[model samples]
Target: MDQPVYSAAAPRILIVDSSRNNLAVLARRLGAEGYRVMVAETATTALGELQRVPVDLLIADLALPLMSGTELTRVVRRELAWRDLPVILISGRSEADGVVRALAAGADDVVVKPFHFEVLTARIARLLERSTRVRQLAADNATLDERVVRRAIELGEARDRLKALEAELGRVG
Candidate 1:
């Protein structure tokens, strides 16, 4: 575990579960955990929410209506392939195979049903911290790349000027 930790801002988490009670409980609890929480009862609504909002992490149920969380994860992975969006798929205790499949489909973690809230929150925090760090690193890398390009251009211009001066010295000498 690389153990990415300690983000500067509270992360926004998106929860997708078909059960209204589950959604409500998760939203309220995560909100209290110093996170901005958004809930969607179905994968489609979750997709819409994803499009409109910038979510740090996603917690989705594996057995969603119409579209399973595995499928949702695949779609999200395809669409936001470049981004470091972490996904956790909650599965029924019976679905070991689905958990494996969901992981293959790009879910970062899996929580079997009847999970401890503490465990879920810990996972959320870790993923959010990692995402924040990855984004920051990407930004820093872009800045460094820009600086390198600028320096290369300046060096090229100086090399050209040096060559012209050498040619003039050759003719004068």
Candidate 2:
């Protein structure tokens, strides 16, 4: 299938799945969609990769060798830097309890096995868009704060000058 082309600077995605076949399929699909894909067989390896490089999104399988996807999501959310990172948990089990647990663990979305590629891509796009909006809002807030601080300092200086002029007038009069 022909995938839509992204910009030269494609968003990076980290995929964690113990199954080699699953890794291959997802890597091919995401890459075709103009994403820079990185693969890890376990949650531990995924964490190590995360430390070395920044990723825009994480797609993890529910079942892993050492650490499960839910645990990985929890750890990612706990880290202040990665708290806003988008996480999508994929699993064959479609049980209600598992879905609840995944959400509680900070997964932004969940997908069941045999899911359509279109649906997965759509979900990914939504999450990325939301993340971008949040980052922009934060940057705007920071700029506004700096401006407020600068204005306050200027006001203080003006007040000091007014006081000095009043004292000089009293002495001259």
Candidate 3:
């Protein structure tokens, strides 16, 4: 299936799974979809990679060799730089409770095993769009804050000038 091309820089995604087969398949699929894919066999490796590189999104298996996906999600959410990063948990367990727990632990979305590639791709696109919007809004807010500060300074100077003019008028009169 043909995927939409993102801007000049392709979005980067980190996928963590203990299963080698799952890692190979997902890496191939996401790479074909125009994403720069990074794969890790364990949560520890994933976290290490995150420190060295900037990842736009994370896709982790719920069952990791050491740490669970939910725990990883919580850690990511706690980090200031990664707090806003989008995470999707993929689990072989079809239980609804697992999905609920993953979301509660701060996963942006959960996908059951044997999920369609198309569906996963769509979800990734939606999350990336939302993240982009949030970043843009933050930048706009910073610019607005600078403008407000500048205006306040100008107003204060004007007020001082007005007071000085009033004092001069009193002396001349």
Best by lDDT: 3
TM-score rank, highest first? 2, 3, 1
Candidate 3 lDDT tens digits, 1-173: 66546555899999999999999999988988889899999999999999999999999999998799999999999999999999999999799999999999999999998899999999999999999999999999999999999999999999999999999999999
Clash pairs, model 2 backbone: none
Is candidate 2 or 3 superior in TM-score?
2
- Candidate 1 to truth, TM: 0.90
Query: In candidate 2, how many Å is residue 104 off?
Result: 0.9
> How many clashes does each candidate structure show, in the order listed?
0, 0, 0
RMSD of 2: 1.9
Looking at candidate 1, what is the lDDT of residue 153? 100
By TM-score, is 1 or 2 better? 2
lDDT digits (tens) for residues 8-116 of candidate 1: 5668889999999999889877777777778999999999999898888999999998999999999999885424689999997757788899999999999998989
Q: What is the lDDT of candidate 3?
A: 0.95
| Higher-lDDT candidate of 1 and 3 | 3
Off by over 4 Å in 2: 1-7
| Residue-level lDDT for 134 in candidate 3 | 92
lDDT of 2 by residue, 83-109 (tens): 999999998878889889999999999
- Please report, in order, the local distance difference test score of every candidate based on alpha carbons: 0.88, 0.94, 0.95
Candidate 1, lDDT over the whole model? 0.88
Point out where model 3 deviates above 4 Å.
Answer: 1-8
